[model samples]
Target: MPPLLAPASRSPWASLPEDLVRLVSWRLLAGDLTDYVRLRAVCTNWRSATMSPCGRGVIDPRFHPRRWMMFAEGHGLYPGHERLCEHTRFLNLDSGFFVRVRLPLFKDHCVLDSVEGLLLLQRDEDTAIRLHHPFTGDIVELPPLASHNLHMSHPYANLPQLRPISASVSIDAGVVRVMVIFIHLMYAAVATSQDTKWTYLMHWRLPSHYGPLSFRGEQYLVHETMNIENTYLSQIFQLEAHSQDPPKLIVTFPREKLCYPVYLVECDTEILVVGHNDISLTHLAVYKLADVVLDRFIPVKSIGDKAIFVGGRNLCVSSKALPTIVGDTIVYRHPREQHFMQYCLNTSSWSLATDECSTM
Candidate 1:
C-alpha cells in the first residue's frame, strides 16, 4: 500500500531481452575483442548475458587472435640508459588506436612469442619457461631448459642468454613445444611439453635461421642451403617431435638469388615465402606455394582484402573484419626503427605509419 503511490521505473537497457543482448554481443565479439570487453563492462546484466573473452582461456578457438601489438615506453634519465615503464601500451593494427592497460606480467618476464592470444614468457635469470594469458592471469608451466646433462655437455654454457626462437601451445591436447637457439653452442634445442628436459638437434652443415612454419596441419622447418654455385635455395624439412629420427627433407625450392633472409608464412590456408631486403625492407617479393610435391611457387600479385604481419610469428588477417585497416598490405617494424612501416602490395610502394609510434 505504501508503494502504491508510484511504481518504480526500470531502465530500458536493464530490461532488454537476454536473447537480443546476446545477439548484439556476438556481433561486437566477431568484429573486435575490445568492443566485446566494453560491452561486458557496461552493467551487471550485460555482463551476465555476454560470454567472457577469457572464459575459456586464451587457447579457446572462439576468441579472436590479438590484432594489437604491445609496446614499452622508455623512461629514466637518458636515451642510452633509459628504463622501460611497467605500464603496457597496445596499438591496434586496424585503426592505429592506442590503449593503455595495466599488466603486471611484464614486470619480470620476457616475451618469446605471441601466438593465438597467448604469450610465451621467460623470467630473467630463470630457466623455467611459462605460458601467460596477459588479461586473465592464467599460467601454464613448461619444462625448464637447464639440466645436469646440459652443463656436462657444454662446460661454458650461459643459461641467461636463452633466446627462444618459437613456441607453440595446444591446451586441449596438453602439448607445448619451444624451439630455442644456443648462440654460444651453435646448435638448436627443442623442449617438448611431455619431456622434463630439452633435446638437442645439431645441423652442422645447414643452420636454421628462423623457426618452424606450420602449413597444412604439419610442422615444417625451412633452412637456407647454399650450393657450390653460390646460389641459395630454401629447403623444407618435416619436423618430428620427441623422435630420435632426423628431420626428413621434403622439398627444395629452385635455386634463386636471395635477399636478407627468406621467411615462410602461412596465409589464408596457403603457405607463402617472403623475401625482403635487410634495410627497412626496401624491396619485397611474395610467392605462394602452388604445388608442394612439385616444389613450385606462383608469384602472388594481391592478397585480396587481407593484411599480413611479419615478425617473430607471421600472421594473416582479413582487413574486411577491421574496416579501418587497409587491405593488401604488409605491416612490419624494422629492428632499427621504433615505428611501424606499411608496404602496399597493390601499389608497390612503402609508407611510414607516422601516427603509430612505438618501440617494438
Candidate 2:
C-alpha cells in the first residue's frame, strides 16, 4: 500500500468514527483520568474492533489515543507473564456501562498506555504492547528500557538508603520519554554513604527491543525535587520533554501535607491537574509549567464528601460532615488575593480554562 489519506474536502475529524471523536474529545476535556474506565464502556463500536486497530493512519488510531489506563495483574510491582492486564474494559459516561477486555501479561504490575490501537505496557523495568481485537486474543511485546540505573530503584542492601521513588513518561518528538524523580526520604540506617538527600529526576529511552516494542521517544527526565520546608508536602512534578538541557519540571500541590494522589492532565494547550482522594486537596488550581507565579489554589468552601472523580471537565469535591468535626483547612480560590472564602460546599463554583491556567 502506498499511503492512505482522508480526502482534503473532509475534515480529518469529520471522517473519524464517532468513537474516535468521543475518545479524543474526552481526553481534551478530562485532564489526568483516574482511569479511562468510564470512557471505554459506551457501545460495541467503542469496544469491539476487528483487524489490527483498523484505521487509515499508519498507527492504530484506536490504541494510540491520548489518555488510557491499564491494570497491573498482581500484588507486586511491575508487569510480566505473572502480571497480566489489558485495556479491554472501558467506562462510558454517555451510557452507564463498563466494557471488559480479558488479557494476560498485566500480571505483576502492568503500567498501560493506549496508542495507535495498541495497548503499551511497562512492567517494572521492561516494556511490552498488545493490540485490541475482540474475536482473537492477540498481543505483541515491545522492547525494554534503554539502560537501567540500579540507583534508580536502589534496594536496601544495594545502596546506603533509598529514600523515595517517582516516575513520569511523556511522548515527545515521536519517542516515549521516561523519567524517575527520586527523593531522599530517610538517612542510612546502616553504614554511612555520601548519599545526597536530593531528588534525582532521571530519564531514559524506551528502546524496547525485547518484545513488540516500537516506541520512539523513550527518554528519562533528570531534575531535582523541590521541597518548601524539611517536611515533604503533598506535591509532585510534571515533566516537559521539549525543553533545553533536561526537560522542564512542573511541581504541583494537591494537599498541603498529605501525599495524596495527584493527576496531571495534558489538555490541547493547558495542563489540567486534579488533586483528589486526600481530603486536604479540597482545593483545585491550574498553572503553566513555565510560570511559577500563576500557580495558586482556587478559593472555595470545602465539602465533606470524599471527592471520588464523578466525570467530565467538571469535578465535585465532597466529604462527610460530622457534627463533632470542625473545619481545619480553608479553600481560597485566590489565596494571594485579599479576599478569602472559607470553603463551604454550597457556595463554591469554578472551573479552569483549558487554553490558560486562569479562573473560569
Candidate 3:
C-alpha cells in the first residue's frame, strides 16, 4: 500500500479562523490600549477581523487602568487653532504609557477634575462648568456659574476669581449626578437631570477644601475645615437622594497633626487624609479614618503594596496592578516646581520620579 500522505502542516496561530482571531482580540480588552493596538497591528487579516476597543458606551470593567489623567499643554495661537495641536496626553499609570488624546473640547476649557473617565471642565471665557468625556467626545452642559445663588454680595465673594474648589460626577442607569463646590460659597450645589436649577446644600462653616465623594451607593462630600484655634477637622456629609434638604453631617474628626494644604481621598472603601509639613521634605503623614464617628485619625505607616498618585486629583492602585509603579509610596506634583516626586512610606524618604512621563 502507498504510504499515507502526511497531514498538511499548519501554523498554530496562523491557522486560527477569523472568528477565533476576533475572540482572542476581545480578550485584550482587559489590557492597556497599547496592547490592544499592537494586537491589531499583528497582521492585516487580524486587523480586519477586530474593531477598535474604544467605542461608544461604558468601557469594559476588565480594563486594567479604569482612569487616566489627561494633562493639558498650553493652548496654541489663533482661534480654534489649538484643536489640531496634540497637546493632551493621557497618563495611564497601569501601562506607564503617555498616549496622546485629541479632543477639541479641551482646547478652550480648563480641566478641573477627572473622575470615572469623565472630565469636569470650566470654560475660560465664562468659567462655566460642564462634564465631558474625552475619549467619546460627549459633553453635558451644566448650569452656568451665574445661575447659582452664590451670594455674590458677600464681601469675600471674588466673582472674577470664582471657580470650583472640587467637583465629582456619578452616572447610573442613564442618569447623571454632579456636585460642585465654589471657592467662596458656603454651600455645595447638586444638579441632576430631573432638576432645572442647582439644589444648594448649606453647611455650618465654609470648608477650606472640599470634594465630592461617593461611598456605598450614596453621595457624600468630604470637607476640610480649620477652627479659630488652628485645629484642623475633617468632616463627612451625607447627601440624600431625591431630597432638596441639605446634606447631613454624619462624621467629624480632628486632624490636628496634619498641616495646611491637606487633601482627602477615598481608597478601598476607606477615607484617607494626606498631609504634609511645608518645612519637612523627608516624610508626609497619612491618616486613615478608622471610625467615622468615634475614632480619631489613625496613623498609617504604610498602605501595603499600593501607591497613591495625587495631582489634579487623587488615584490609588495596587502595585501588583502595575508592576512599573512603586508600592507603599505617594506620588504627587510639587505645586511650586511643577515636578513629580515620590514619597516612600517605608523609609519616609522623598525622591524625584526619573520616568519622563511622570511629570505629565
Q: 20, model 3: CA deviation in Å?
A: 12
Clashing pairs in 3: none
Model 1 lowest lDDT segment of ten: 76-85
Candidate 2 deviates by what RMSD? 14.6
The digit string of per-residue lDDT tens for model 2 on 254-320 reads 3442233333333233333333334545444333333432665443233334232312222222223
Each candidate: how many clashes? 0, 73, 0
Show model 1 residue runs off by greater than 4 Å: 1-31, 59-61, 74-85, 147-152, 155-157, 173-207, 211-220, 226-231, 238-250, 256-260, 266-271, 276-284, 289-296, 304-344, 347-360
Which candidate would rank higher by lDDT, 1 or 2? 1
| Ten-residue region with minimum lDDT total, candidate 3 | 56-65
Candidates arranged by TM-score, highest first: 1, 3, 2
Instruction: Supply candidate 3's per-residue lDDT for 163.
Output: 63
Question: How far is 312's C-alpha from truth in model 3 (Å)?
Answer: 6.6
Best by TM-score: 1
lDDT of each: 0.61, 0.33, 0.61
Model 2 alpha-carbon miss at residue 205, Å: 18
